[model samples]
Target chain A: MQKHRGIRSTGIPENILGYLMVAPALLCILLIAIYPVFRTFSLSLTDMKMQFPNMAKYIGLDNYISLLQNDRFWSATYNTLFFTVVSVALELVIGFVMALIMNMPFKGRGLVRAAVLVPWAVPTTISATMWKFMYHDQFGVINDILFRMGFIDQYQSWLGSTSSALWCAIIADVWKTAPFMGLLLLAGLQTIPAELYEAATVDGASKVKQFFRVTLPLVMPTMLVALIFRTLDAFRVFDLIFVLTGGGPGNSTETLSMYAYTTLFRNLNFGMGSAIAVLIFIFIFLISLVYIHLLSRQND
Target chain B: MHKSRWSNIIFYVGVVIFIAIIVFPFYWLIITSFKPPEQLWDIPPTWWPSRFYLGSYIAAFTERPFLTYLKNSIIVATSTTAFAVFVTSFAGYALARLHFKGKNAILALALSVSMFPGIAIVSPLFLMMKEWNLLNSYIGLILTYTTITIPLSMWNLTTFFRTIPADLEEAAKVDGASPFYTFIRIILPLAAPGIFTTAILVFIAAWNEFLFALTFNTEDALRTVPVGIAMFPGQYTLPWGDISAASVVVVLPLIIMVLLFQQRIVSGLTAGAVKG
Candidate 1:
């Protein structure tokens, strides 16, 4: 399955031509990806504001030190981690179940499959705004329904209280994204041969036993891939929090990305913001490195 | 024992609730959008429209540059998608199929950039725009957005390219056609579906992109729909009717696009999610 890429062709002229043809792509990455990243590293040193003298004094490590001590930084980190872990755990379990349901031979499967994607298809900001309305204190639909059902007598401001804000945001995210997880898991599920399930059933393997022995092992790698993608996405979350609570009823829902954005543009403290950015970058890089090692091991 | 009837009943109950969680918000938005101004705060809000009115939509545009903003969003989204799909395809094909040296390294680097957090570099990016005199320009917004989405588009496009058999390209090469010629005439025709898929995916991403739209565009005129619509209820006394109307207009086009390309979108989700 591995396509070896150690220079297969012999002719020098055509090889050079091939290289020329691919220059635009290399240019895009150089101009877009590599350049912005370098700029990010550079901008971290500046105490730039929104106004003139965009470059501030290069207070090298002071910004980094200040961020390390900031109380808000610790709180944001906890919220980010909480948001990432709980939503992902919930998504994985529910998504796994949804994927399993879709995998079954059911009537109206095609219609149901498309219906599952309604949330994922909607734009993030749009969906967040919509959910915020539903979470509105006075007349939001969620409060109304819960009130009628005797779940909570007082109107639950889902995005207002510190206790509930982050989870409320995650509920919106999970609603919007779980279908995506289901779709991905379903794809992974399809690749699994039905014959494997057949072989297990014939071997007198209990359904639960078969799942543990056969399904879990085969799907773990794919599931982990999904896990890493979702985890990284959850870690850098911004737009939803911004729209839902504007980082809160007093910074209750403020995420690291929102914090970084606030420090950079809103507050115009590029040095501190960039330091925060750098921290996030390092954290993400370390996480990916671990996952890459795990993934490659599985590949081997 | 096989699954009990009670378990099946419970599963259906769970399924109905899950479907409600997904559907109600949008349904409420649609219903709210159609209601008249007096009904905005009606007690015990109706699930369906009380009466259809076009006034909110009219008010939405009258209050702001709805058409211009929509056009600007279309221009930015369309151009970014076109550039991304065009550039990434050539590169993706080369990386996926060409037996070039250091392809692995290039692929790895590309993948790494894809994972780079958007928030990590957006500030620096803002500074870059200011330096370049790109303040409130469509081109600037497009350029920055193109960067944010390149990794995603490239990965998907490359994978789509990789799925194509090399012999297809080679067959034309063997027939005395040049590689570029074969690519344009032979490979591209067959890759039309992939191309379409990439464009739609990239377009939706760029269209839905709020960070750059919010960060890069300071002028009211330069704003895209997401940033534009976010500003609808901006002032203290926001006209609720207009906000709902604008929301409907902004989101409807996207929903329509998805429905039109329903097949491709589904497959795209499958590839993106399943392959991870």
Candidate 2:
């Protein structure tokens, strides 16, 4: 008990010491993460082309106005939203099934778990590239397999056509990320006690009913959290699209992040690029707000 | 009994199919790495390479400065892990054990920062790096990586530090040990497993990061593995062989790490999600 007094009587006050301890990390976040976001917001207000930095000037809401009228921006937004909704929906379903399978008492579960980590462990660029090769129009295994199975009469260019390119990218994304979602849901599933399931079974509930009644309700919070995480991640899809199709067959698969990269780096349109970047930040910020609200509700 | 048998068959079949879907791409990657160019372009791709032709692996290293990319990735990832772990340990300790004002605010800040879309901050970070003349340097990427890695590391370490009893710290305090001193000498060693877990996760993240690495370091010599493999010249013909080989080289170490530290990684990842 006297030892507690010793801690209090130390030279530096605990609050100040705490602040000092956290200063470096806080500074890093503010400078590298928080400040840059504000900088991008301000940059979005100016007509700052990277090529001619000297001609930069404040052009209040013109960039945003133009972005609203620009068909490309709308298309990119549509593409991003579509990708997010489709891929996240697929990931959630596939990942939920994976979780259910993983939660079952099975032999060689460790090996299955490790195997599931393969896609998640691979870098996004690498996985995208791998899938790109597999979707190669002429020499692709996917085309070969589909043809052999009599699914298609001719080998189709999966990534070379606009109609199918985005879907192809979504498939690749679901493949890469479903494992991660599975892992998160598996953690959630593990926390559910076996007693509840046993109790449900004893009450003459079928397996399917037990899942809907016992499993789903308890895991709802975790699923919601995982859903938002994947939604936000899917919304920011960049590396996969970058390497897989370079947001092409046209701008068909161009995500907001990819569009921002092209504008900022390739086209060197700093202001427009920043505008796009700011929109992405806003979208992600809103998604995060929903997450926080959900989390708070769960806590209550 | 009949119903149980039917369910058992379905369960095993589901497990097998799921595992196959998950493992097929990796198997494809490994096989492609060893395939000769002739076999790679076969009408129907060969499921198995006829021979272990090591040409692609050799070419991947020799054709481009891949060794440099590998070196850069190692330097950036290791430096980021070291810097992030050092910075976050103190913050975690403070948040976990200390009685302080605005602790919740800081925690909330960290949580939100973890979810920040990198595309938003990238442009300004690029300009800042340019202004500081760090665009092509390891320091620029390392600093940026530390920023992104800090929040999770803080959360994870704080969760870990909370599990450790305060009685040990009190005893150390009574023996005239300074808080900082007790932290470095006593607390850190005690939290080594948590710290190591955080380090592995952070290292994997830094290793696999693409957007920042791609944006900041455009110089050929400065590229990391992800960017290097991605930006491989395919002007005439895409070098599938070399690219696959390079992918294998980079992915092998990560696979090994995940295998060795599977349980630790799971717990570390879910620490924030499950408990928060």
lDDT of 2 by residue, B132-224 (tens): 999999999999999999998999999999999899999887777778778887999999999999998899899999999999999999999
lDDT measured at residue B178 in model 2 versus the true structure, 0 to 100: 73
Docking class of 1: acceptable
Give the per-residue lDDT of model 1 (tens digit) for B5-88: 778777777677766766777788888888887777765555666789888888778766877778889999999998888877
DockQ of each: 0.46, 0.66
TM-score of 1: 0.93
> Which candidate wins on lDDT?
2
Clashing pairs in 2: none
First chain of candidate 1, TM-score: 0.92
The top-ranked prediction according to TM-score is 2
Chain B alone, candidate 1, TM-score of 0.91
Compute the DockQ of candidate 2.
Answer: 0.66
